[model samples]
Target: MTVILEATERRILQNPLENPEVLIRIVDDNQATCKSLQFFLEALGYEVRIWNDPELFLKEYKENEEDGCLLLDIRMPRISGLELHDILIKENFRLPIIFLTGHGDVEMAVDSVKKGAFNFLLKPSNEKKLTETIEAAVKLSIENHLKENNKTIYREVFDSLTPREKEVVRLVAQGKLNKVIAADLNITEKTVQQHRSVACHKLSVRNVAELVEFLKVLEG
Candidate 1:
């Protein structure tokens, strides 16, 4: 199917704010379809990268580094798109994934969506809908990337705490009072207060609720 974009339509989809620091990664065994999607997306000013083989795509893909949503064909040679999505999930990849599927593969696409795929585009997708979906997916990919980066920084800060501070943070996050923590760790309340104060400063949290939220984000 030929995809035509009117000048106004192009303008609507070509907002720079919507253009994130992300490329469109396309993995499809069908050369013609790949070329069509690439052309359509690139015409709308998106940076696109294509791979004809799922294995090659997997080898090249890195979590949070490549930083883009995936456009994958649901049925492929060795590793199916669903299988690839599973592998990415197992490896803790948080980028949005958009699957390309035929009518027969709708069930698999639905299953992938349930497993956190961004969305699936039917073969011979509508030009308007495809571009809109890709834009939304790119925005989501950027948000996910920011979240993963934030998590990394938080984990680093959490790791920088001394063992004693770590214990204090753990107990505090578990809703233990400083006196209870001191008793549990066989320390005076004054020592526990000192440790807790330092931990709070290091973690940059003013209160126990904030510290617990940080811990939750770090763990996630």
Candidate 2:
């Protein structure tokens, strides 16, 4: 079946950042289904990875390090899609997952969603729906990946701050006056100002407000 996408979807695909080496991982034991889905997604300009064994998919998938969404089948040999989803969560795998279900597996699919799967597709899924779902999943994967990357970068920057600077900045963000910060840290007000200035420069923020906002992103 031919995949049909709206103009917005096409525009999103055109943006280079949206395409980031992100993968669409299919974990279905059915070889034919995996091959067909792989071909369809690749034709639409996505990198596809297929695993016929749920165990292998789990073993190979690297949490936080890999950028992708999972396309998991709800029913499989040895490990069902639901069971695999549980395993991933237990292992702290945060990749968005989309389950593929047959007609009789609706209940299980719904359960997967409740347990944090991105969404699900039915077997013989509509070409348009499948394309759209995969696109949405990939976009989410990229977003999550960038967010985690920022968290790492921000954490490193925060770590680079000296203990005095860290204390000063924390107080500054809490609306403490420089004099109060100096008294709290047992330093001169001028020294507090110096530490705050250095921290703002290291964090690339202009003032306490901006630094607070930057740290909020890290909190997420």
Candidate 3:
């Protein structure tokens, strides 16, 4: 229900490009618990935002530009944490999620993890465990963000290639030699080689191995 910014004034003044922001969003119905966590996590230097209403959080939460993670309570009034997690998954939300579960909710929490929630924290969690889990989730969020960004860049570059260039790249990815590709396309081997060179240059790939790896990532 509250967004706490307890970071020092000096920390706030620093260039975000140099010190990227790390956000921790908490969605729990209990106001007291939310405030307690907000104070604790903010002291640890995270930008914390809490919500008492699951529906409100769902309505307001968008894909974050900064590296971050979500701390969600397992049991709530309207939308349970598991249900929210499902919706996020269906929407392709990639922020790492750490579920806050009560003793009776442990089994459900485990199931949520299997379905792609990052991890779960038991209620009344110890400070050390909570901090460690949040740190790991933030790290993962950063890595995932970087990978998605790279994929976007790769897709843009790939789309820029001509149809013939794309066909040549696909053949090369299938381990075809220039002569074999030429025969398949009914083109000269020299023309096939030219397409290969152009594709590699456009993709910024130095060799076949690199090109293959790039294609693998793009396909994945």
Ranking by lDDT: 3, 1, 2
Task: For candidate 3, write residues 1-220 as lDDT tens digits.
Answer: 0012114322333422234567889999999899999999988878988889989987888845567889999789989888888988998887889988674365786688899988877889999999888887877776666566667877888998999999999999899999999999999999999999999989888787878878876787
TM-score of 3: 0.82
- For residues 1-220, write the lDDT of model 1, one tens digit per residue: 0012124324433453454566888888999988988888889878888899989877887632655578888789999888888998998776788887774366776787899988978877888888878878876666566566667878888898999999999999999988999999999999999999999898888888888888887888
Rank order (by TM-score, best first): 2, 3, 1
What alpha-carbon RMSD in Å does predicted model 2 have with respect to the real structure? 6.8
lDDT tens string, model 2, 1-220? 0012134345544462355577788899889999999998888877888899998877787742556688888679999888888998998787788887674366766777898989877888999998778777777776666667667877888999998888888888888999998888788999988998998888888876777777777687
Ten contiguous residues with the weakest lDDT in model 1: 1-10
lDDT of 2: 0.78
Candidate with top lDDT is 3
Which candidate model has the greater lDDT, 1 or 3?
Answer: 3
Assess every candidate by TM-score: 0.73, 0.84, 0.82
Query: 24, model 3: CA deviation in Å?
Result: 0.9
Q: Which stretches of candidate 2 lie over 4 Å from their true place?
A: 1-20, 63-65, 104-106
Estimate candidate 1's alpha-carbon lDDT, on a 0 to 1 scale: 0.79
- Candidate 2 residue 180 C-alpha distance from true site, Å: 2.3
